[model samples]
Target: MANMYDHAYDLEKAIRESEEFKGLKAAYDTVMNDPSSKEMFENFRNIQLELQQKQMQGQEISEEEVQKAQSVVQVVQQDEQIAKLMEQEQRLNIAINDISRIITKPLEELYGQPEE
Candidate 1:
């Protein structure tokens, strides 16, 4: 049964580690990626442990196991990176607005642009 269990681990690891599986997994890992979601991670960790145990055996996996795995993955999604990008965009917008404000300032300030 060791071989069987080994195959089970290998299969789970493969699916978990593969790029294609990751694309498929994005549906369930949103909170897990957040720095403040440690509880969410622990909660998902319990569910994931159950799933892994279910996976470690040759027994058929329940739909609940699959669902839990999907949900955990969703919790850990790469939202932080997206959030950082959004923050950068906001900063850029702010900088652009500041630049525009300066350019549109009183002509006396520019000593020019009093034309056009």
Candidate 2:
């Protein structure tokens, strides 16, 4: 178990050093450093988190909530810095998703194989 935990920490370190994470960090810094983009990005993120939380709680997301998120997204999309930040975020998410899939592959193969 200790060795497994050590390996997990190593994986975390590797992820932090990865290009995807570095790109995300750079884009995030750029967005945060710019006063104009900072507020917009933060609001956009808050709205996104709220919507996600609502869904996770099994509560219905109203049309108004969806529209609010969409409007914020539209506004953010128009800002170059925010757009770049979003692009980097998507790349990082994709990389993390791939890692998650890879980690679960053995379990998936074991449980998902069709019986002969």
Candidate 3:
């Protein structure tokens, strides 16, 4: 029988082979090859991480914080390569989330739905 580690490795391999992952990698490479796009992408990522950290810490996420992240997203959406990368990343995220849900189904069924 396959162990948990073997299943994990297989999942990783599946993700690496997914079209969404490939598209994301290609889009990332294209952006990294351009100085302006690379800078903008990094800035977007930093702002996103900051907002996420604040949320994780139970801090009140101010309207300004949300606006700041939105502003960066607007700018990112203007760049073709970066926009494509974001789309691909979203697709990959959805796939990963699906996997998470599937893996947790049994536990969730046993314990009932978790609080949002």
Candidate 4:
């Protein structure tokens, strides 16, 4: 029988070779290859990380900060290359989330599904 860790490594290899991961990598390369797009993407990512950090620390996000984040989101969404990268990222995230759910099914079965 295959060891669990070996199966996990196999899954990791499979994910790396998956088309969704390839598309994400290509889109990321396209964004990073252009200076303006790369700067914009980096700024957007920074804002997202900042907000996430604040939330994790139980800090309240200010209205101005929210507006700034929204503005950054709009700018990134308008950039064709960044937009494509985001789309590819979303596809990969969905695939990863699905795999996570599948892998956690045994725990769910043991503990039973939580109430909605």
Q: Highest TM-score among the candidates is held by which one?
A: 4
- List runs of model 4 lying over 4 Å from the truth: 113-116
lDDT of 3 by residue, 58-78 (tens): 999988888888888998899
Candidate 2, residue 2: lDDT: 70
TM-score of each: 0.33, 0.88, 0.87, 0.94
Sort the predicted structures by lDDT, highest score first: 4, 2, 3, 1
lDDT of 4 by residue, 51-86 (tens): 999999999999999999999899789999999999
Clash tally, candidates in order: 16, 0, 0, 0
Model 1, stretches more than 4 Å misplaced? 1-36, 78-116
lDDT of 1: 0.58
CA error at residue 34 for candidate 1, angstroms: 9.0
For model 3, the superposed segments whose C-alpha errors exceed 4 Å read 113-116
Candidate 2 vs 4: which has more TM-score: 4
Q: Distance (Å) between predicted and true CA of 99, model 1?
A: 51
**How much is the lDDT of residue 11 in candidate 3?**
90
RMSD of 1: 23.4
Predicted structure with the largest lDDT when compared to the true one: 4
lDDT (Cα, tens digit) per residue for candidate 1, span 5-112: 787677667656755445434523443455565455566568768767767886788787788688666654444543443344455556557655764577647675
Predictions: Cα RMSD each: 23.4, 2.1, 3.3, 2.3
Across 21-108, the per-residue lDDT of candidate 2 in tens digits comes to: 9999999999999998999998888888988998999999999888988888998999999999999989999989998999899999
Report the poorest 10 consecutive residues by lDDT, candidate 4.
Answer: 107-116
